[model samples]
Target: MATIVKTPAGTWKAVIRKTGWPTNAKTFRTKRDAEDWSRRTEDEMVRGVYIQRSGSERMTLEKALQRYLADVTPTKKPSTRKAETTKAKQLILNLGKYSLAALSAEIIADYRDSRLASTSKHGRPISNNTVRLELALLSHLYTVAIKEWGLGLTFNPVLNIRKPRPGPERDRRLAGDEERRLFAALNDYSNPMLRWIAVIALETVMRSSEITGLRCHQVNLQKRVAFLPDTKNGSPREVPLNETATEAFRDALDNPTRPNDCDLIFFGEPGKDGKRRPYAFTKTWGLLKRKLGMSDFRFHDFRHEGISRYAERGLSAQKLAALSGHKSMQQLKRYTHLRGEDLVRDLDALPKRRPTA
Candidate 1:
């Protein structure tokens, strides 16, 4: 049973008189409306499908975010750790106060609209890729909670919609003057060690991940090769050294350090003074780019450059894939898209047109 009444504010409300599975709905605005809704709710409850009001027992978006961050973040790659942390903060600001159970496809769609209206500290518009990552993080947590933790989720709204198109691929490969400018900027590095670091960055195109993880044992200078235990591809690959790389290693060996230190190539050995710290690629990456006045250059692009440069030089897709450690040539081929010059060169090399007899 339910009672309907007008409030002091002159709005109709309903009060439930019996316990129901959905916690006994309270306000319906009119007696007839209240009765109809209550009957429907009661019927659903009888079928054991009714979802009651969340009220005090509901989990909040913020709580879900914290759980995801604390439990799920540690297992991710170091590069993604910062991104996941940032996503958690953005979710807190966007959907924090909302109840998890109350979320629906419609609500999340509206949140996407709101996310587009948001900007970063740099005043540039947020990209669809950035927003997509945030949604992905949320979606993953929901899945974990429902499947592994058994939260009884009937639907995951995030999956119901497609993410927006990602932003245009920023040009990553350095060409011509940009490469020269990059080296010019590194020229004034008073610390010879930093110079060696920059040179190695250009020569090997090792990611900051691989760079920081480098150990002396990983470098087989005797064989002019370096083996990565795990690259971005989740597979190991050996990087062959050129004379330029060999020279840089020689400089690295001569680079100033404490008398007794560990085998770390970049950072000095941990807990020791003077160049024993492990090489931190990110710290120097920003300065290197700024010095070159290159806004679009990324450390990751160096890898792209290394792969694509000789990729244009007629390296077989299989060989390139082996070097880059890409699981498939499908994705790598896109990066090595042939240029007009390549096409023209191929056409020029075609057999001369024989005179018609």
Candidate 2:
């Protein structure tokens, strides 16, 4: 019930017609190949398991990734979008020639292994978390292609591969005289904004992005609260500001050289688009840290330090979670590392029980 014909170019074509199904056609270089495809397609149609994979077969990974970047990446957070764009370029370099249908689990597994073995430009081994994020992007692309783009993919190859284990949580807190020295160095710096930013981070457990991304209207000095309409977890949070944090915010807001063109609290130099973005101080921060001989201390550790201090002061986990914008106690626990000395002091402050006669 199938027709096979040799075209002028000498390629064989197979055409199948069924009552319940739409017309299906395929071309092959050999008559046998065409006949085999026709038989397989007809059987699959009868069994109600046939899927037209021509679209997926034709679309290369590079083209698909480009489409994903154009259509999907813009919807994500700025940080997430930047990371995915970088990952997409790496994916394109390695396996972009393969079609969606041809990208099997085995191939993806090999890619994962190779990526794990690779080193970053800084000569450090690539972290498992980085590889995992890359795989996540690929997996989501396939899901989108199938459900939304109608690419005819039967499955996501990334789902079948083993993900690398997550990296260990960093518990690096400020030690001994390091805090004193760090503040001294911050005080001496020409840029007073650096000192203010550091003070705010120490007082309030706000992330570096959250601190830098603050708008003029988001802070209420009278109410001593900073409102975050957008956060990493997709939740709005109101961070309570203590006296120290309020002072820092006031300094940044009342900058004499502050431009009227931008409402950003920490406005950067004008970009190519003539728009002032958030202050780009990563390089400066890193250089300052290294100069102060505290290369191991990261900006995020400030949040950890602040949270730990709060925990030591007898703040309940529920209260800490509310202030820190953590959705769960498990997440809050990572940031709250109470000192043993503080615990001992608290224990001594408790009323002692009288010895029984």
Candidate 3:
């Protein structure tokens, strides 16, 4: 129901009443316009369709960008964090003046093209991966504005936009010959500690960080095991030492000035007077790998080689999971890609079927 009444000044006021909606009232240039609004309001109310009004259309894109950056900076890797922070800060300074609502899909597409058109600081064309990352940050800012800050965003216009294609995957593995080459190179090195650490890393499959943070008191020669306190997965477990790895532990203990601190087993990287610090492979391994003619391989792949070797020998999933400290079989499967051979071997062990009639 709607009512129209002329005021003393000869201006007309219109009022509408509808169920499940607030009373709507307004004045228009014509009675027809007021009546049309009343009818639309009644239809919308019946359909339960209404958008929360937005101030985001007036808010600058830069304001939302700053808030988004602060939300995710702490969670990135140390090397990546600094660069992301710088880029986010710079983008805000450059792009912050535009209104969030007015930054349409076409505008974002153009922005992506412009980034690709520009050359980077390193004299390379800006990568699609980087462009995608920057656009992701932009999208995330809009999401937070709507979901977290109660900014009443009626639409996330970036939803239908396509991200640029990423680069090719890097598949790097150390062949058996390369492993032998690395071993021979280690044997030739003067630094006994680095050599032993390299060998242990290959055999035990310990991560670089794990090796650096290993503790003296954690090794038990009697039980032939070492306890890793806190690991990447946030789970602590025991690692049994092989003969070579145990001998390496003995070599680490053989150092003259055994520190009082039980933390950090594999140490010594020059300076600070041989204090127990993180084991460093950057200098030695880089030179060694280059000398051995396998520069494409990474130090982390030693862990992969060790686990793959075990899988080749037919280690069970449960047993392999324990040794590797992997929480899921899916993760274990990634390290053992060729374990399908084990499946074929199991085929021969099936129970003989009864003779068919």
TM per candidate: 0.80, 0.92, 0.61
Instruction: Flag regions of model 1 displaced more than 4 Å.
Output: 1-57, 268-277, 281-284, 337-339, 350-357
lDDT of prediction 2: 0.91
Best-to-worst order by TM-score is: 2, 1, 3
Q: Model 1 TM-score?
A: 0.80
Clashes of 3: 1
Tens-digit lDDT track of model 1 for 120-189: 8999888898888888988997788676654556667799877877777544667669877777667766
Worst 10 residues of 3 by lDDT: 167-176
- Model 1 Cα shift for residue 118 (angstroms): 3.3
Global lDDT scores for all candidate models: 0.72, 0.91, 0.73
RMSD of each: 4.6, 2.4, 8.4
Off by over 4 Å in 2: 7-11, 19-22, 340-357
Model 2 worst lDDT window (10 residues): 189-198
Stretches of model 3 off by over 4 angstroms after superposition: 1-72, 75-171, 257-262, 268-276, 339-357
lDDT of 2 by residue, 1-357 (tens): 789999999999999999987787888999999999998998998899988888999999999999999999999999989999999999999999999999999999999999999999999999999999999999999999999988778999999989999998778889889999999988898778788888988898999899889999999999999999998888999999999899899989999878987899987889898988988788998998999889989999999999999988888889899899999899998888877888999999999999999
